[model samples]
Target: MAKWKLYWVESDGYEDCFVVAKNSRSARSVEANMNGFDISDATAIRVMDIPDIFEEKADKKFRDWSKIHAPQQANNPDLHEWPWYADKWLLEELGAQFRVIDNEEQILLRDIVYAKKPTGEWYTYSIGARAIYERNKDLPQYDNYDNEPRIDISKQLYTAMGLALTQCHEIEFLFSNSFVFAVSEKQKKKYKTFNDFFKGWEKKTLGGLFSAMQEAFDIDPEVKMALDLFLDMRNTLVHGITTTERYDINTDWGQKELLAFLDLFLSLCDPIKDIATSCFEVSIEIANTYLLKESDENIPIKSSNELLSLFINCFKLKSMN
Candidate 1:
């Protein structure tokens, strides 16, 4: 048996991909064949040996489940027919998107490689730490007219700012869904009515959602404080950035201010991210609790009302920390 080795392959103008092959030559060949690039022009760096039993059982279980439940059409899947599966799919998709955005932000902050083009525009690229070092190692250092090194600080800050805002938006969406699940439980317990006050709640601002959540539950003070700080930073980036003349992207002083703002923004992201993570955890737990039977057998799916009790209970238990 040929032992598979992990390799990181990079080709010009193509997204880097990982391949499992017996050797570096095989890895390059695999990438070239997969991406329609010439093997001669591809660079393959051996990463490590592929673990034989990494998630083997889980992988087989998922494969079996997928074979049973896989949608027939790419876009026409009847996931909605199974509410539990639909919610599970949606949550997984959201988590994947969040991870991608978070990773892009980290790459921009750490592994970015950029240069000024002939057209006076900046070109920035990143392909993780190793690829970044490989590509940047041979580049000649250039300096500005004042003997200072030429650096695209503004572009980095601008990109980082955009990513930070995007992450905030994702967090808000997750928080909003969590609030709905929690509030739905409250309504069912108290009014015994299916009336949802938070319909079209996504249209509301994050501040409004925060207020509503506070009024609906005994939210942890630390969570509230973290969310308040996040909201303040998010609002400044969204609303105050254009009107505020102090933080200009065109000058060194303005760029410094922008960097400072971004630093603080990123610092606040950890706590907010923790809260979002808690929301996801509770939502998944609620789904598992109500959607699956104890014997791992499919039962008659209950109405959303029945599920709401556990949703709010899980939310309160997880969010209070």
Candidate 2:
């Protein structure tokens, strides 16, 4: 058997799919069947023979498990519902939505829009740009005109940090209460005029909030550090860029520091993702599974709570594979 890597374009963007087939002909057959196209006429489909990295990494583990579980797999049809099997099935089901693209081709946002358009809109736009340029080739081009100010957080690292923190907070919030409380008898006495006293406990910054959380609850040190670094990096970005309230992603060290911060952020947040996934399995999975019908269509999440819960479930489901 040969392994093949398939690169396909979809509505969201690009995806890489791997499959195992008996031969070149068998791979083409599988690809054709996956897209519901006539095998002889499917021009968009492409496949490259490659070694399967997953099998290469987990060969021994899979072999050991299969020795004991192969019989059970044959006996139980619902074994397909397991994460590995389910993910493969889901990818196959979604195959019809993707058209094969050349692996070497760098797909731009415009390429996706062009592929989706029914008419030759892409050609028209290209022709128009060429015409204007051809007529005014002597026009002086200015460099970096009215460009947005550059900053460390404004680049790719900022986006990664944002997403990582968002993921971390999804788990953190479940155990954290947003509201403040008085811990001491003296503080509780402020209940006589609670309205003015409550403001005293409000955290001013993300660091302050996490610090307060640490004081009130048994927070993991790693989790606290993650929160602190995220806020500190953010503040660095802000002060480094703007005068008012803003967090800068880059410290004084430049791109190297930005990368270092991003590395630290991911390392800190990775285990929290695992923890959150575990919590989601225990707290949200069964109830949310029945909320939406099991179908191929993209269903709208009806509320913030439902969306948040479903988002974590997706993370949990993804981690299972």
For each candidate in the order shown, give its overall lDDT on alpha carbons. Answer: 0.54, 0.39
- TM-score: model 1 vs. ground truth: 0.41
| Deviation of model 1 at 286, angstroms | 2.7
**In candidate 2, what are the lDDT values of residues 10-127, reduced to their tens digit?**
2112222233443434444554666664555432223332335443433444444665877554444233221121123333332212332222221111111113233211111111
What are the clashing pairs of model 2?
A: 234-247, 234-248, 237-247, 237-248, 237-249, 238-246, 238-247, 238-248
After TM-score superposition, the amount by which residue 70's alpha carbon in candidate 1 deviates from its true location, in angstroms, is: 93
- TM-scores for all candidates: the values are 0.41, 0.26
Tens-place lDDT digits, model 1, residues 32-60: 77678889988876544444443243344
Q: Model 1, stretches more than 4 Å misplaced?
A: 1-152, 184-198, 240-243, 287-321
